[model samples]
Target chain A: MSAADTILFVAAWLGLALLVAAFLLTVWRVVRGPTLPDRVVALDMLVGIVIGFIALIAIRTGFTLYIDIAIALGLVGFLATVAFARFILASKGRQGAGVYSAGAPLQDTAPAPDATHVAARGARGKSAAKSAKVAARTSGKTSAKKSPKSLPASPAVAELASVPAASPAIAPGKAAEEKPSAKSIGKPANKSASKTVSKSTSKTRSKSAEKTAGKAVTKPGKPAKGE
Target chain B: MDVVFAIFTAILILGGAAFALVAAIGLNRFPDVYSRMHAASKAGTVGSGLLLLAVGVHSGELSVLARALAGFFFFVLTAPVSAHLLAIAALKAGYSMSDKTVTNEME
Candidate 1:
């Protein structure tokens, strides 16, 4: 073997070891990460390193299979990243609870998915990740981040809305004629009476519940339509 | 020339192995997540480079050496990029880095 060849081979070997070390570090972070996105990101890094290793070792073994492995990994990894980003977006309380009337859109008054909202969501991920870490550290604050997703359904709110504070929302003429009794008292309009629910009340906002809320915000034209 | 080549490969492989072993140990030994990352990225980079180089020397064929060199270069470029991205992720995820570490003073 030539002196230069020896040097180059040595170089390749050292690179392999370093990449392994980096992979191990990434693995540690993946397991230790407090939130879903962090683990996802770490997984991405680990996959990238795997591709790099296959390519390096292929050079030594004189086989084409390794490079093929690298190519396959690249394609699969891209798909995984996109899917993860969507998952993260879907988890945030996008809308309110319950199914919308067929014509109603989400966030009636809130502006469309403009560049600004997109940027804000991106920014929100960063802060949310920070919050997740904080949540992990404190453990006690876990539920605080979960309450908004669990807000009462719009249908429930609407039922509460139509009812008067003291009685059910019956036709006004008939409701007046009926004498009130303890057994047949009117349904109280508790919906409007207590519009603001404490966000701190619920914290375990699972994936499905957030989706339900996101779908429930169906005010057609109002920007902040009860989403 | 032949004797020198053999000795060089021996040293290269041995050093590369030693670093790999240390990084493995560090993963278990380090108390915190950030310190473990440091041990892995820095030591792992050097160790892998040497191991690949050793392979190139052992293979001795022209085509093989050329390919090994490409891998070597790729490793050199990507190691630090991955490390930096990992660090960004670590910070963004909020695993507290060494408080005294000045690398991210701006943050």
Candidate 2:
């Protein structure tokens, strides 16, 4: 056997060995990727490598049937790529532009009127009436402090004076300030927000891919290794 | 003559092996997805081309030789195109870049 032939024999064997290793790496990425889009990217690459390998094998074994595999790869791979991209995009609807689509948060259930508030107001009004009558009797001749605590008896009138205090104290201060919208109320607000962000980013990613691939790939004339 | 042909075939195969080895190593060692892709494309297309060339030489008949040649050229034409598509897809899928190679507007 010639030195060259020995080299070729060893090289082809090694080439096949390397391909095995590469395939495993691709598989690792495919399996371990954190997200759907990441796995799709790895799978797309793995398919391309597979097609190239098939083409090489056809040339090595002189089997045109293998070329059929390459052709099939070309057809199927493109479709699969598109499908995965669509899958990524389909998942983005909630993540981006549709963020507001989560709808308005429902208002807090109005607190039920309780006896305590009514009773407290009633007590204060009676005392205030008595104080006011005392004040009128004295006619400001003697020096005594007018107690504001002794307010009047009509419950609505007491509430009228106390509307600002009642309103502020009735509901939580901050929550009312930033009231959740109808849609977000009693709903998974955070989960939907995260989902929408993910989907829109995925869509942006696919759109960018379409742009990069817009060019025709240049195939240089250099001969491949063996022939 | 038989011995000579066999020896030559062996060497050609070995050359194919070396290129494949480099390609595989590149796939593993490259810093980012795009670089790994570059490795895969080069090794896959060109390494396959070499292996086929050796096969054609070993076969010796014009028809078989012609087929090998066609395969080599076909790989040359299509492998990069497919690889490019793959790389672009990876980039779109948010493959992180370790190095900023260039910032062309078309990118």
Candidate 3:
């Protein structure tokens, strides 16, 4: 081979080795990342390393088209990162707390009460109430500080409180009968309350009651009833 | 002239590969995500830019050079923005830096 050809061949091999190493390291980060955002960041870096590899391949093969692939990857990679970020943000908003820590347990991230959880809680009577009580106790200090006006104004909490505390003794059949009408009444209130909460407390807790409400909402399902 | 160009291309390509290897090492060794991102974004961009420049030099075609230049510019522009966004997302997700990291931002 000519001198230039030899140089080009050696450079290509070196570049390939470096790119492969980068790719593997990025993959390790993606696998080992403690948090969702960390994984996202690692994924983003992986895309970048892929782009670099594409550029190297284009140079080695003298295929101009591959450069276009690198350009498209750059654009699409940015969009992917943004989309992942949005997903995490939406989940955070739904969970109502900073439960995104990598080391934290999954149970800690119990999401806020949505319609599904509300329905489920209604279906499971005594167990749900016990869980709610547990949640209420854990979150009691925060709830105690919240003003009654704010407390009742939040439709989800209001609907929850409006449920006759005595209903725990009532059979599920009768409780179901009463819950439908109450949920219907709560539907409009739920929307306005969610909007206000989302607006006011986009980041940190505006009031601890919201966190308590989230816990209470999710609590009713599977808390080892005898415990 | 051809020999000189070939020598220059060899140096650029080799140097770029070395920088990339360093970047990969830094990514693996860095103590925190923020610092790893710092290494990946800055060194990775420069390394890629140099490799593109080498490719442009080796090709000597106006079209290929133009394409390489475009690729370099696009890489430079987007790499930093993505890094910054990732850092912001990490912070928003409540990721604390290593305790050894000396910054008063949290305080």
TM-scores of chain B, in order: 0.79, 0.82, 0.94
Off by over 4 Å in 1: A1-227, B1-7, B28-34, B92-95, B98-104
**What lDDT does the true structure give each of the candidates?**
0.45, 0.47, 0.59
Identify the leading candidate in terms of DockQ: 3
Which residue pairs clash in candidate 3?
Answer: none
lDDT of 3 by residue, A117-204 (tens): 3333432356554454434333332332332322322344334444423222223233223322322221122222334322322222
Q: Considering DockQ, which of the candidate structures 2 and 3 is the better prediction for this target?
A: 3
Residues A158-212, model 1: lDDT tens digits: 4433432322122323212221221222122122222111110111111122233
Off by over 4 Å in 3: A93-227
DockQ-based class of model 1: incorrect
Ranking by DockQ: 3, 2, 1
Interface CA root-mean-square deviation for model 2? 6.2
Best by lDDT: 3
DockQ per candidate, 2 decimals? 0.07, 0.15, 0.17
